[model samples]
Target: MAERDDLSRGLWAVVRAMWSEIGPAGKAVLVALAMSAVVALVLGVAIPKQVERHLIDAEIRKLSRIVGAMADAGVIPTGPAQADELNALDEAVRLNLLGSDTVRVKVWLVDGTILYSDEPALVGAKYSLSEERIDAFNGINSVDIPNLSLRENEFERGFPPLRELYVPVADDSGSIEAVFEVYHLAEPIETTVGNIQQLVWASISVGIGSLAIFTASLILVYGRSIANRRRLAEKLFGELVRSQAEERTRIIGSLHDDIGQTLYRIHYGIEDLRSRVDADNPVAGELAHIGELVNEVDGSLRAELRSLQYGTGEELALGSALDELAEVTEMETNLSVSVHVETDCELSPPTRIALYRAAREAMTNVRKHSLATTVEVRVQRQGDQVRLQVLDDGVGIIDDEGLGLTTTRERLEAIGGGLKVKPDRRGGTQFSAWVPASECEVET
Candidate 1:
């Protein structure tokens, strides 16, 4: 039972995967096929059976009219002279109406006696009338295949399969005088029914096939349109990321060249003034304070420049870059940080920048909002993909940290990567990111 349950689960999983891939139109096609199959089966069975029944019934009615005329004329065998008349009637029928299609003919009395039969041995034989034959005596006709298992059909073994008809012959008083039993060669009726069945099913097949082809074509066109939209979205996103990166580079260059050099000049002038001024002068103390402020601002600008320089350096592998990032996060946050690097793949500049910035922003958020004791950053490469996770044991995020997370996610997605932030089991925030490693060459 357990094995069966497991098998069932696996089967359902496969079904869900297939359904997800095929889209809504494909699902509709599946439903259409099932419905069409049922419709075809119902029509295939009912139409052919109905056609054959009508054909056999018309034959039974025609034969019954001839038998009724004979009974009204007292030509059906009730005595020796009528028996001779029945023989003469049979000769006329054989020359005119009875050919390859007629198998045998019999006239039965109301009391279940065979008054006249084409087969001489059956004449004057008393047999039990079937319930269906009794129904025929009440002025109804029935057509069916003969049941060979019945004792009455023992002599019928030498013949081919036959369709038997039981029809009533009524007199002027509306009382049934006799029952006409006609055995017909079923081949012609069966052949015609078979032909009709073939036509009906062939038309259904063509209709269903055309519908399926048309539906599939529409689905293909819809799928192509969706694919084109996705491609357009990705292209736009790529342009956005490129623009953002270029802007960051420009800002960093301005900060380092313009602001850093100006601060250095100011600090140097303050130092030269300090060397020339008296140690007890109040101006000397103010200059030293000013110099300290300048040095602090310069140090801050350098730190920001280092953070922005991720992925710009040609010598860095992704694993080594994340390791360096983890160390810096630990120094700034004063959190116990453990860094794990399991793979060494060299990524393209834009991809590496996306991953690196996402990691840096996550760590920064943890440092700013999470009042926790420890942080763990992991970087690993799996088949065709690389993953990075930053976890911090802190008070969980109670509110949304809007821009930091949203921008990080957008940047990652722009480069065909993803970011996820969730509360870990230990009530800490877990920031996870993954990107396709297939775009990167493995470092030797």
Candidate 2:
């Protein structure tokens, strides 16, 4: 259960880290871009067809009106509007609409005769609108079918394609009069629509390409930024460890050169004094007893001296050493401190120094300024690095005016360690340091 919980926590942490990198700005942009793309797809593909159909309808109605006017004025048909007049109107319609090579317009009688046609040879031909033959026809209409005949005023292309219109003319009686035909070059409209489609596709492709590149760029920038920060952090940890090791070595050397020699001299003098004393005279008896006591005192002193292991300069065992330093410091300064140090692995000298100095600096700050009664030093090792924390339940820092922190920071930095002041999770200023073991291991 514990392992599972740890794994779940780790996965969630990774997810949170990823979310932090992408952020809200990126998500909003992606959503807006997606909506825009949907709109573009609809507009680019759908609008042109609608426009073309509307244009064709309008042109067809106008054709019917023009032809109807001619018929009403006795310009076409027999009786009041005779066949000669009808022929004249037909010729006029032909001349006007079919004059252009690109346009083919024709008029057909209900009997399927090509009454008027733009193509001369096709005039008077039989008309058969098998393509658009319908159950019922609208007044003014346009459709697309297959091959169109100019003479019969009938046209064909395809469904919603090259459009042709057939408009029916009506007299005062509202009777079906004649059919008027209008021609439109749908290829141009289709071509224009095609061009628009190509442009839209191109634009969409470019937009998607750009979006992909931009997204990739953002991810890359964040990734590199995080990587650089991690590198800097690691380097700091290494330096702290190395600096701590160096400080420990220096302190050990100091102990050996100063206190060690003093203890050695004291031991030898005690030995000589004991040898000189005899058991004969009364004064000698008293001196002999004092000399024996002195020998016991010398042995105790020698035992105390052994604590340093003369010039051993061995890496300090993490937990015990921190407790010892705290104990000695409390005795000297009258400051009450609780040291909580634990470690699972052996520590290098540099890492130990970094942790110790960081704690010492915090203690010094407490002693000089905090005037607090309780101080805490905690050190723990996790995996490859050691983390140390120092906290004081003293008066909070007064506007951060102290050099101990700066000096401690410098010392830790010298060996690639990190020092930072954070609001103690428990309500105080906490100084924390971390150093890597690899950096702390000094050459013997």
Candidate 3:
């Protein structure tokens, strides 16, 4: 039972993986196909058998009617035959046998004595009545398949499958006088059944085929719609990214050319004013203090502008950006952090920004959550792809790191990149990301 449960779990896991690959619409198509196949199989087996049984029933009725007609005409032998009666019996059997399309015939009395048969040796033979034969004497007509599995069917052996009909013959008073057992050539009836079966299955086959085609068309329509939607999404995302970058560039340009130059002029003007004043004058002291404040403000402004430009993917290489971030993290967290640029390659603006953000986030996580000390950031160009890794000798991440990791993943995926976080062999977390360099342009 445990093994069975394990098997079931394994199967369910496979099903789940398959479901994920195909998604909701594909799963619906798969379900529809499975149901259709089951329905077709049931109808294929059931309809043929029902039709074959109806044909056999018709044959039984025809045999019963023929025997009834012979009985009414006084053609059936009633007793031991005299010379004239025997001659009459031979004539009756000879005429009726040809019209009946039967291989053999037996007319049996109620006590199980054969009164007349087409075969001379079977005539006057007394054999025990079979249960099926007894049923016929009681007015229940029966039909059976050709293979004789019963003792009373011994005579039916050695022949290809034949239809055996046991029918009761009634007198003028409506009493069953004897049972007429007829063995007819089954090939014709079987051929008719086979033809009908073919027609039924052909119709079913056409229906199933039409269903399959319809289902396929439906899946194709849905699949194409999904593809179009995905393409539209990617186009929109790319446009948004470009729009954001342009806007950021505009802002940074304004700050640098307008606000930045204005601050520099203010600082220089204060310096010149201080230089012209006397050292002993109270006004000179005031000017010097003002100049020192202006200088400090200018320095802060330049730093802010640099950060803004980096965030906008301008004026910063990926390796230089990561190296700056590592240095800042080391100062702030008192952790040993190192950055290495192992490849000489340029990347598109979006790729650069994405990888920079991923590395920065990983470093931040290491500082905030991981308690261990040493950290290393590495960047390399591998074929058509660029790879980034942040390795730290810190206690690995716990479950509650929250939306930072999720946001980083989304950012990477938006630019056709991926991220992975795994435990390093040295008991730290390794954060890795990669993107196709071909999808990016040379970093400006």
lDDT of 1 at 181: 77
Q: What does the lDDT read for residue 4 in candidate 1?
A: 86
TM-score of 2: 0.40
Residue 352 C-alpha lDDT in model 2:
60
Q: Least accurate stretch of 10 residues (summed lDDT) in model 2?
A: 131-140
Q: Please, what are the lDDT tens digits per residue for candidate 2 over residues 1-444?
A: 977887785665555445444435655665776787787778767766666666566665566666666667755552233456656876767654544323655555556555555555666677665434221123434555435444333333322334555666556776544555555666766776677678777887788778768875876676567546545654676675556557756766776677667756765665566567664647666656665765676566555455444222334566666676677667657778787766554555545655666766677677787767777888775444578887887667667646767877776655445687766666666778876543222211
lDDT at 350, model 1: 61
Off by over 4 Å in 3: 1-34, 74-94, 97-100, 146-158, 170-177, 202-222, 252-444
User: Which 10 consecutive positions of candidate 1 have the poorest summed lDDT?
Assistant: 13-22
- For candidate 1, write residues 182-203 as lDDT tens digits: 7888889989999999999998
For model 1, the stretches where C-alpha displacement exceeds 4 angstroms are 1-120, 123-151, 164-184, 268-296, 311-444
Tens-place lDDT per residue, model 3, 357-428, is 788788778878889788888998664458999998888967764688888888776555689998998789
Runs with alpha carbons beyond 4 Å of true place in candidate 2: 1-28, 61-65, 68-83, 109-114, 119-137, 147-163, 202-444
- Full-model lDDT for every candidate: 0.75, 0.60, 0.75
Candidate 3's TM-score reads: 0.51
